[model samples]
Target: MTPAARTHRTAVLALHYQNDVLHAQGCIRVGLAEDDPARERVIAAAGQLIAGARQLDLPLIHIRIAFRADYADLIQNCQIFRQTAQLGAVKDGTWGAAFFSGLEPIEDREHEFVLRHHRTSGFIGTPLELLLRKLGTRHLIVAGVATHSVVEMTARHAADLGYEVTIAADACAAARAEVHKASLASMSLIAEVGSVASALASEKDSR
Candidate 1:
């Protein structure tokens, strides 16, 4: 990628560092892991990705999942979110809906954008496209939780929407190792799949 183009790349953290997903007592933490080596590794990689993006001064876009208290905006047809409704997870204004501490953008960072979505894809029903266009984002560096769900869906959607997508495989997590690997394989067909270090290195090389 050209240096000018790479300068417009956005680092998207999709539901990775969120209370409902990454916390020990989180409602959906069961979908990933707790006190496990794989989970720890994933978290560490994602944290490094965030730190790298900050070092590069890239736009940091934090995508979170949240629904209304009454679940009116949540579609019951989506099987994945049914568990969220049942468990009362990610309710707006609750701790479960907040971004994890030490992982979110600090206040007064003008380039940092936080988006709340009720569905799997970040672009769906969100101003993400408009924001990206406004920011002139040509590529996306994606890292998130539940590789088979939010991470995969967002990467595919971004690719189809004309944005170059790169999946930080090491920075993504799933309910199981097999599932995570499967998701990465599937995503590799559509987007570049690599570790956070490689992604950052690619950016630097491009520059």
Candidate 2:
């Protein structure tokens, strides 16, 4: 098949790099060990990815998962959502819902945007797609926590929405190594699987 024409407009979607998921005191860090090398690697790589995006002047969109204090708007269709309220994790206005250190959007920056979602995919129940459309972004570089869920689902949703999707594999982490590997493999079928370095290089080259 012939390759699609490059649009040159790309944005980075940083999802779920919140304190509740990455912090040692996070409630959602249940199965994730505080000292896990894989988790640390993800944090480092994601930090690098964000820095690279900023240096390249690419639009950076930080997607977070947060619910109301009582979670009245939260859907309970999934175990994760159900457990969210029980664990009191990612409650809006709490530190747990805040972005992790060094991974936050620069306030007052025109290129940096923030969107919150209650579902697994950033596009669902959020203005992510609308914002991307307004910015004329046809290509997306995605990185986030829980490769099996948010990363995978959001990339898939972006692909289905006709946006070229690339996953920063090294910038994503899961509670289990095997699950992370399996999720990346599965997502490869729908999105380009690459590391933060590769994604940055591609963006630089495109410019």
Candidate 3:
């Protein structure tokens, strides 16, 4: 991790909304009810990252996708999920919109993350930057599923904003291994890509 990212409010994004929309098969699978093995693994990986980060006490946060009660707050702004809504997907308060379990989510607690609605890039519609700025976070370590989609897009935005970014390699996943590796390859020259252990191994190095 770059000096900027290692200390700058490192946040590991947790995963949800595992749709088959980008999968080999064109099926929008639901959560545990219609669990996808690949998606489960992705969630499991994210959970492990969250648990471990807690152990490490990294300045972390969590985010989940959602829509307002009227849903009017989103429809026009969202390009991707707007179409998804047409397909009977991602209702506002439904189970489908909830972040996958195993993230060690708190019922009611401090430092909890805010939920976003139809916002693809976590930083786009949310006050993530303001929150980070408040925390004095200029560097970010990002992790989650589907590196090509959400992960890649967010990383690009982070870099453009002059925030040093590192994507934990093993902490994220794509629909397929090829896509995952390809996304990392695309990011390697731009973003520091490595495992969570290797990313934080430097704390060990500093010792």
Candidate 4:
């Protein structure tokens, strides 16, 4: 293990690693872990990040987006989600709603938990804050699909809530490279945006 993976107080927040978004047969996998070069980079980096976090003994929180079978909790106020409503995207208890096969937490890991959120920001409707507090998280390392959406929103919210945020650039993917890059640039103002290696360095360097 690297020195940084020895004694870090960081909590790794992995978002939207669901099969529906990452797998080849997933409902929206075209621009994610499938054919998109940008997203492919994110997936590769996320694999490394996950390995590093495990070695460092950091708390791992997997956040997924799931809605009720009846779609009662889905917000139809915007067109972006209207498609979800129509297609029944990520309905709970389905294979598509489960975490991607390779990314599920090991059963014996004590500090890891899977959570379901109904919105873009993981903290808005979830126990993420409480878990972080319990883990005494001083820095949050965020990685997930859809950099322009969930990843960016969560990082901003975490920073505003007084936690130092670190965006693992290569661990976040978007439908388009431009959108991904733009979101990262925008979030750099509020959080430290870098590759998985650089983000891990911060964890090692933190007091």
Candidate 5:
């Protein structure tokens, strides 16, 4: 990690790694093949980051998008929200809303938190910012699926909330390469875009 990260309270924010967003049969996996290398790469990179956070004793926060079975909490103000409601995706209590294989929170882990939201940004209608403040988290290391949406939105919001955000670039994916690249470019303006390894590196290693 960078010197700034070593001096500040930091946390890992893993967003939208649910089956409904990354699994083969997921409604949101449009334009991406089940065996897409990009998807696999993101899963692996994110897994590594999570493991690293656990070893470093950093808080691990898993954020997912889920709605009531009746879609009562879902707002259809955007195309993605409307599609989610139409496809009946990410309903609480369903397998699709579960975290992707090997990425789920460890049961009973004190530092691991799982939060559910109904919107694109994890902070929207959620206790994410409050939780971060309680944890004394000034620096955020983020990794997630759909780089162009949840990841981008959350990073931007975090920056605006006065948190130093670092996005694990390789740990995030989108339906298309161009979209992912564009989103990353946009986020670079407000956040540090780096690889998982760099984001998780210790200060000694950096030296």
Candidate 6:
């Protein structure tokens, strides 16, 4: 991390399942696809450490999945909903259905909220933006798996909500690094993208 930024409030959201879950975790993983394994591992580690820091009294906001029984909306809006549900990709009331383990569940934590969504954006079909506003969060640092999907979606919503968003580029792993990069480039115009260390350093400097 550098020493160019101050410590700002951050919210970390885990994108998919991981080693904390069973082998059937989730389809989103690194190296196993067109993504870079090394980048994935690094981002995962950064997220883990950030979670730990948050747990240790550092300012951070955490978000996770809270599945609901109603997949009807998804069924109507998205065609893949039923198909992925059949594959048990994101089954309700299951461990794999929750957030990755490295991320501490915000369940009982302060300024924490769980958002259940049938789509990619956590803010979509959910009151994520409201919760963030209540938490007095002006800055959001996003880091998670599947850069092309969840990470991108959330960042876009954040921008629309007028939040200063920053994506931990290296802290995100995806099935396609190129696509992830493309998303990052687009997001940078709307938000900002940086490595975890660089971001942390920038945050520390801001403080």
**The candidate that achieves the highest lDDT relative to the unseen native structure:** 2
The CA-based lDDT of model 1 is what?
0.82
Per-residue lDDT tens digits for candidate 4, residues 55-96, read 777888889999888999988887657877776679999998
What stretches of model 3 exceed 4 Å from their correct place? Answer: 1-9, 15-37, 68-71, 76-79, 107-109, 203-207
lDDT by residue for model 2 over 1-207, one digit each (tens)? Answer: 997633328999999999999888898862578777766778899899999988988889999998899899898998978988899999999999999998888968778899988899999988888888777899999999888989999999999999999999999988788988999999989899999999999888876
| Predicted structure 6: lDDT | 0.60
Going through the candidates in the order shown, the clash numbers are: 0, 0, 1, 0, 1, 11
Model 5 per-residue lDDT tens digits across residues 44-88: 998899898898878899998888999988879989889888898
lDDT of 5 at 97: 92
lDDT of 2 at 140: 97
Query: Candidate 5, which segments miss by more than 4 Å at Cα?
Result: 1-8, 202-207
Q: Which candidate number maximizes TM-score? A: 2
Poorest 10 consecutive residues of model 4 by lDDT?
1-10
**Per-residue lDDT tens digits of candidate 1, residues 119-205?**
888888889888888778888999888898889888999999888889988888888889989999998888999999999899888
**Candidate 2 weakest ten by summed lDDT:** 3-12
> CA lDDT of each candidate?
0.82, 0.89, 0.62, 0.82, 0.85, 0.60
lDDT of 4: 0.82
In model 6, what lDDT does residue 60 have? 54
Clashing pairs in 3: 169-194
Which has the higher lDDT value, candidate number 1 or candidate number 3?
A: 1
Q: In model 2, what lDDT does residue 34 have?
A: 79
Q: Candidate 4 versus the native: TM-score?
A: 0.89
lDDT of 6 by residue, 39-90 (tens): 4465466565475446544445444433444544445345435555554455
